[model samples]
Target chain A: MTAWLLPFLVPFIVMNAILGIVTYVTLLERKFAARMQSRIGPYRVGPHGLLQPIADAIKLMMKEDVVPTAADRPIYNLAPIVFVLPCMFIFATIPFAPGLGVADLNIGILFFLAVSAMEIVGLFMAGWGSNNKYAMLSAMRAVNQVISYDLPFIFSALTPVLLAGSLKLSDIAAAQAGLWFIFYPVIGQLAFIAFIVSTVASENRAPFDILEAESELVAGFRVEYSGMKFALIQLGEYAHVIGASFLGALLFLGAWAGPGPEWLGPVWFLITAMLIFLLVTWVRWSFVRIRVDQILALSWKALLPSTLLLLIATAIVVVWRGVPGV
Target chain B: MTIAAPRHVELDYTGSERLTMNMGPQHPSAHGVFRAILQLEGETVVGVDAVIGYLHRCHEKLAETLTYAQYPSIASKTDYVAAMTSEFAYVRAAEMIGKIEVPKRAQYLRVIAAELQRVASHLLWLGTWCLDMGGALGGGATIFLYCIREREMILDLFESLVGARLLYGFYQVGGVRYDLPAGWVDTCRQTVDVIDTRIDEYQRMLEDNPFFQVRTQGVGVISRELAQEVGIAGPLLRGSGVAFDIRRGEPYSSYEDFEFRVPVETSGDCFGRYKVRMAEFRESLTIVRQALDRLPDGPISSRPGLKSVAQTRIPKGEAYARVEGARGEVGCYLIADGSAKPYRMKWRGASFSNLAILPHIIPGHKVADVVAIMGSVDPVFGEVDR
Candidate 1:
């Protein structure tokens, strides 16, 4: 039991830290967007709105958790937790710094991908359990969109795996020590673009956010959720975004392998990780959401074909270059 | 062996339970507090039933209690987005029934003011429609803010002419209550010139955007025949290839003197309606420029009299008059029993009749198309439920 405790305790600590960062990410997202729009955001709180999230948390905590009498109680109660837990689980394999990861398992990449898929199930539960037609409709869209886009997403992810010759995330990182995959220049460029597109869709962010289009669906699947439960769902979303960004930086941009010795390696990795997250957020704030069919069309008609070609090209490059021993 | 089996069997018309969804009298996109009960199959809308009267302020009943002089102020709230058109139509109706002829100079100023207000109102619709389509971060709001900046200039011109900004009761039974201030015409010309430049820029950013086009085109198609059947009017009617602009047909105020064409589109889809509204703004600009060019010099009001002018009492009769409002033909039916107040006042709100077609239009569209249809119709709830 004590032996098992160490492994369990490591994930608990790592997931919580990621969760805290995600909360601040939400606040920063608003602040960055406000500055872009030429308005001050949440400034009346403690010192440049550092305490705004604290206030929000307290408010959410105190509000009555009203369960709709018409709702499916068991699923309603389970939805937010399910939505949040997979996001938390996704953090385990994200290599934050050198030797700082929670899991260095051989199939760490697959572990993250499979766990993220649970977000669909969780969102479905929220929508179906709410007993609202809007919720149900939104849920159906969420499932359909996620499934449709997931194919290209997973296919594009294969490019880096082929190049690295291992599904283990740390090994993939070490493989990119000589040259980052994005440095594969043009075709490598195509794969990176494909990866970013898929990841954003997978996380359910803007430009592919048709599932929860507020004007069209009225809060979408989260329409019936209130108070802390709603906040938990939001926290899960931000966590997924941050987690995905870190993994993207790891896979394509080279994780934690910066200019320095091993001890100072983790700090540079954290900065790179932050920089990647900022880049993703900038894209989120700058673009309008595309239509559902456009996103689906992009996946099947454009990205899928491009990803297939890139995978084959990367495999050719890997075989031609004579593989290395890490 | 008399007859072969029927080639096609009719779909079973029976009691399959239809899912009913209530889209509110208080829902965000119903354009105010207007309720629509949508009967759906899965996500497809089978039928829609609208229940209005939620915003019914009983304006007609309120008009019965107010005098002709007091009536224009009350009517301002009916289509509150473009109050000038509402006030103008009511006063025109009263003047028509009362047998008072407004001066020619004031008529040009009225045309100028009303045309400017129409542009401002249409610009507002453009902003809201884009915002509805693009949302906050999509750069959708960039166009909205830009439009408001131009509209503010027009509103400033209104302030210069009338003292108030939004609900200006400048139109009187005889002519107008106020005269144009010094340098007002030149200032307006300069403002309109700047607006003309800005409008071109906005078109470059938004009008040609393929995403914007795909979102709008053929989404909410209202056939010309169906539009006539449903009693749809205004830009919505004109979009269906109707050449029935009240300004062209009846030639109210100084509209007959203006050389502007009534903008029309043949498709009658949401995109066609959007294009019509966009062209109408340019036509209004032409009308404004013409009115400025040919604005004659004279008194703003006529002489006061007991029956015709002074006493503000209409002759015992009835009259129906309409002016092409920003939304459509805003007409008023005034019944005068030789009283200070009208015997009966009924407004033919263009916004109201235009909104009635939504139940017929939105049944086959996706939920997103529902927003597009409501936006293209551009119903002001204050008018619809009045």
Candidate 2:
């Protein structure tokens, strides 16, 4: 029985752990938003809204599933699955502790970026398949906004690689043990800043959340969505945000590199990821969304150029002070 | 108000298809049941067609059926946000027709109430308008909730006096119905002070946010000429550099006794409007403080006699009384036929005119700016549809 269950054990454990964290992250966002707005968030479900996510999950599950009659049934059915699975797959490459992840791919950084980008296809499928004008408009916006920021996001991620001389996340994290790439030099700080900005834009968060802007598009691509399908899409979004946050911690903040016993490595990693998530929430609650054109211009005109300069500078620095790993 | 919308001109399209997006009879930032058919060429609003009268209650017709003294109740309901200003306008018009002399202390009380109402209305606008702009402008609902929380204090002050909170038809033909409750002035003073301090916190949070600036600055610009042509009143007009405040320009309700600036801005944009309203809050606090300070000691109301609301005979005459409401000028025109009821009544609300500039300015801006600009105009649907 031990031999038979061994192969699925790590995947089962990590999947459940991620799902549990993502469920509570939504609660965290709501509570944080409520505090920012000067109101009690969700206090009725459990002590400090602890059981609110569970209640929400059940409510969503029980709700009658709805699909727009005009929608492409197959793609409409498939979109959330497409959106959610790839987001979950991103965790496969993320090394939580010394040996505490689902799988340790050699090309983890590349795989993470590639898998994360797959989220757009699902977003587009949902947008197009829904047969809604607002959804179509949202799809157009998500395409423009997400694709534009992808350049800077990828370019900025290369900065840590430049400093570490490795593409593997664990190797990259181990390299950050001495000093996280965020503090390496002038270019390192700028890259970190760029990466954070890109992450916010990439995840379709506020100050860049023109897609689901309630006042404008009125729920955007998720306009026609209801019940469990809606929940899945939301899950996919929060999952992506937290997943990217974890990747960010691993790349820049020295994953699990805090003090205490080596066995407490996973706890340290969780704390850092959570801190990053809190920072992201702080930004989301504090800023208003810019226009679609403004978002695109900011990425292409501002962030892309700065990140490219940082990349070139990092390359120059890497050669000037030749490290043996490359 | 009959808005003369520009003729819809089909743009010479090079290739792309034009999409007409229906944004609310139920949309979040519509204020009320206002629908705008937006013709968009990639988010730029080429043309906008407004659908109105969604919340029509036939207030003018309803006023005709009500008695002269009882009409203040209807007036209060018309401009729901700043009910005191509307109530004051109707009461003043009746007082003028009947030649009812208001007591000195009662006049001061009216001034104080009107100013407090303005503060309440403006606070609500500040919150909802910031909410309309979403998080990019004023950090979204933080400002909104804070504004509401403070506005509730002003409501509490009203509730203590009038026995009702929002729609208090507290004014009478001769003067105000109730005198100041014991220590009410001090409570009011403290409330305004709290609100004044809270306004500074909003300024720090939103007024200094660079992203907020980008979203608002130079976005929904209504030129001075266009504003005058549209006859937009209050902040919407004043934001375009027009100095036509009924309070300062043509003083009424002993407005000349107390001093306050009619805050104006030249840009005539969303940011300009926002700045004007922010400045107006401080100005309102000044007016409230001044009125309370100079509140003369006298008969809290007129001597119980001929000028009683229900029994008072309205003479055969026509009188129009206008006051600078929180939105703008709220004018009440009453023509009494020597009967208990008015012959014909016309309530001219500022929001009706303010809503007209929407189509003119909306053509060049994005769909999102529609919410921001509409919010900046601050049209209370009750006032507009009435």
Candidate 3:
């Protein structure tokens, strides 16, 4: 009975912790983006806007859930839940520190990548069920964009898997104990760059964020959603972004391997993850969004072929050097 | 029934369904209260039906009711983004028909106000144009905030000069109502100098940026012939290789006293328009500095201060006055019947003419390019609707 309850308790705790972190991550992004834009952002709530997210959460919960009359009832109602589940589920496989995560599966990278891509299903459901043209158009663009970028994202993630000779994310993190993958001469740098570019595109950030372009599509697939549903969709997006940052930290930046005491490993991992998140956020705030055609052309003509080539080169190097752990 | 008689059927699979999307009057990037009903084939715009008059306040009819003394203030509402120039056009038309001799000092002061208004208006155009293209949450907001920072300084200068920030009724029938206050020139000089450096910073941020280039370059091509045929004015006209500027072609308000260059671009694309406005920023600044250095000391008004609504009356005649407003050539056509109020007043709003080119050039472009082209056109609906 204790063993069964423990299994459930850990996941419940992890989910709550992630929810808290995701809310704060939004505050962090707002403050950071505000700094870049030369203004103070969200300083009226708690001291320095620390409790702004909590206030926002309460406000969203209290607001009435508005449903469009023409909406496909079941799909519109369930889309946010479905969209948010996969985003949070990706975090289950990410090893925040060695033996510190909810579940460190053997097929960690693959699980993370596949689960992250599943958000598109919920995204499309929301777009199609909203019965709005902007939502429908944005949903179509999301399907095209997410499917195209996923390949390059997978190819780049596979580079670390190839270097470590392990499918486990813990093994990948451990292999970078000697030197972080980002500092590995040429191949690692090239693969890391590809990973970041694909991450930005897959995350629907600018200059690749043409789907929910505020100037054109308004809020895009989530335009019709209000109250808790809008909050859920926003949570899923930030959770996905945070999940990618964690994966990037583990894959390239030697997560949990910084200089400190053994117990401080998780702190180092959090700091590293935050740094990666900031890097992506910086890119998002620095460029205008490209057109949908241009975004697709970039993914196919530039990111796909180059990441494939880099993956092949990594495979060749791994075979020659007999893989690090083996 | 179809299976019983399977005749050879011709199916047109090449033609896709056209989506009719309404953008504006409530859009985030509509710039103002203007709407475009776009017929879209996939993402490409096949046709656009623009709708205006959401902001119309019957300024022409108001001109018929209000005297010349009161109309200049209302004229500022037409092109509220450049209130000084809008008021300039109306008062210049009154003075033209009335044959009122404006003092040299007043004319120079008008030049200073008009040039400063140009800088402020162009700064606003740059900010909103980037905000429309780049988005409110992205790098476009960065540029937008920075541009607004500089524009605020210019507004502060206007606030000091006219005691109003946005819509200033500084011009009267005969001359400007206010003279330069003590040490205002020093403050004006300092503000323009700071804005000059700030413009360089904006150029560094956006000019040569690949994202900006991809969005603007060759996106909205207004051919030289098309621009002339459509009767577009100001930067839209200059951008398309037309060297017709009201300031140079027909100088008014002692514009001939100051020397300046009008920038022209032959490309006639969005980027060309962007370049024309940026160059105009520097040229306007130069004019402000020159006018400040040579500001003569004399009375600000040729006529006595207004004591009644019908103090300034025009003889029965008609005259057209055009000023190089920040948007384009803001012209006022007035016909007075020996009364304090005009019998008929027609406003030749530059944005109104500039927007006419939209339907001519908008077809065959994507939905995204629509905003880019509209941003480049920079239509102030206050003028367009009026």
Candidate 4:
């Protein structure tokens, strides 16, 4: 039994690292915004607000979780669990560090994509189950917007997979030893930009946050959610954001690959992950949000054509590189 | 009031597949207790029936009970955002009916106060509209804070002149309640001058921004013909390239004396309205600057003593006085009825005119366009549903 426990302990350590990273990601987002807007954020909780997320968690748990009387009892009760479960499941597949990720499956990219798509279902359930009109409207928009934008997102993501000649994320990371895709002059850089736009759109970030336009829909889908349920939903969204950055890093920026001793793969992976999260946070605060139709237009007309071209370009590159072997 | 049957307009109305959604009465973003019953054919709006009267405090009915002297206090509720303009229009209506002569100084003071109020109202609208467009991530709350900062300064000037902040009961039947406070003109002039410089910052933040432009440009288009038929006024009308500003066309309260241009936009969309308002902000500051430069020196009140005027009450007559409010043309129709109180006070709130255009323009657009349309129209339910 003791011999069997050693292998299982690895997953536990990796899981704890993910949880700690996500907690600190929230702290980093706040700190970045505060610096951008010229204010100090969350300095009083602990040394540089290291304990802020803990204090928030405690506060959320202590607050009254009021379920509206008119809400659908079963679905409303289940929505937060549904939202949080996918984020947890996603963590199981994402390659955090070399030999550190729980499952380094051959079809890692496909699995990640499949699991990530489940977030829409959770959002739909939460929105519809709230029994609120605004929530239902947001849910409807969310389904349409997410479904429409997914085409370009998936197509753009296909480019790197084609170039690397494998669906495994670890293999893709290893392929980018010399140069990340973003550094590849025009074609690769365009594909990378498309990935960023689609990733941000899919995660329901600003410019694609129609589901939660506070001034327009009055908190939109989450208007009825409160207390611990609301906190969990927010945590789930932050997790999605972190996951998106990871996806971007994996596909375009060359995940976990940095110059150092070969043994320092895991440490570099952690540092790279933190850098990606900060990049996303900076993007969120720096601009005004775009509307739904604009996003749709961008996805359908702009992103679709550009990504298709990039994918074709990558295919040609692969064939060119392979023909010399004969 | 005849109820018209629903129009048989051939729209993209797929009846069976559509989902009917109800928004508001409880929703915070509806802007002061309003509701819209929308029939959506998949995210595209097919039919929309606006239901108001939720915030209907029966202001007209409430006004019947209040005496003419007490009316100034209640008039502020009509358009709460720019309460000073409401006070000016109502008191001017009373004076028109009573056949009293206003002092030159009082008239000038009224113009200054009303113009300042317009700037304040426009500032609030610009801030909130950006928030509505940008959501939380666009630094919306920061714009809200900056707008309120300028508005607070204007309100302080109102307080110095009229002795109250939100509801200034300063306008009397014949003239104003008091003269301008010493050094008040300089403070107001300085505030206006400083605000003129900061207006560019707001434009840079929202106007030239690609995100803001993309979200607004070519969305929520209202044709010129439709605008006229629907009686859309102010920025909404002007956005469609119509030159129909009441201030310019029918100059009220020394407005003829000022040289200013009414900004117009060719595109009748959300972006057009936004551009017109941004230009109008600069125009409003221009008007305030002009008023302060030529501010006359004399009695600010037509009625010298309140007790002396109380002996000779307003005569039996009726009159209508209209003013260019922050939203559009705000009119007050008053009947004296030979008493201290008005017999009937009918208000033509700018929000009422602005809201009438929604039903005409709402069709053939997605549900998301509703917010853009509503924000462009700039209806305050405190006035619209009042």
DockQ of each: 0.36, 0.55, 0.76, 0.45
- What is the CA-based DockQ of model 2? 0.55
lDDT of 3 by residue, A230-251 (tens): 9999999999998899899999
Please report, as a residue range, the 10-residue window in candidate 2 chain B with the lowest summed lDDT: B1-10
Alpha-carbon lDDT of model 2: 0.86
| Angstrom error at residue A54, model 4 | 3.4
lDDT of 1 by residue, A1-326 (tens): 59979888888888667767787777787787666545577887899999888888889988889999999999998999999999888878876665677877789989988888888999999999999888888898898788877777777777788878889888888898898877865756888788888888877776566667765667789989999999999888888888787777887778777776877766666676677777776666544456666667777788778888888887888798855415
In order, candidate lDDTs are: 0.80, 0.86, 0.90, 0.78
**TM-scores, in order shown?**
0.88, 0.96, 0.97, 0.88
Worst 10 residues of 1 chain B by lDDT: B1-10
Task: Report lDDT (Cα) of residue B43, candidate 1.
Answer: 54
**Candidate rank order under DockQ:** 3, 2, 4, 1
Candidate 4: give the clashing pairs.
Answer: A207-A290
- In the range A1-326, model 2's lDDT, one tens digit per residue, is 59888669989998999999999998888888788878889999989889999999999999999889999989888998999988999999899997778778878889988888888888888889999988888988988988998889999999999888888888888888888777786877888889999998998888788888778878778888899999999999999999988988888788899889998988888888888888888887777668887888899899999999989998999899884233
| Candidate 1's DockQ | 0.36
Q: Provide the lDDT at B241 for model 4.
A: 90
TM-score, cand. 2:
0.96
**Higher DockQ: candidate 1 or 4?**
4
Interface RMSD of each: 3.0, 3.0, 1.0, 2.6
Best by lDDT: 3
Could you give the fnat of all candidates in order? 0.28, 0.53, 0.70, 0.51
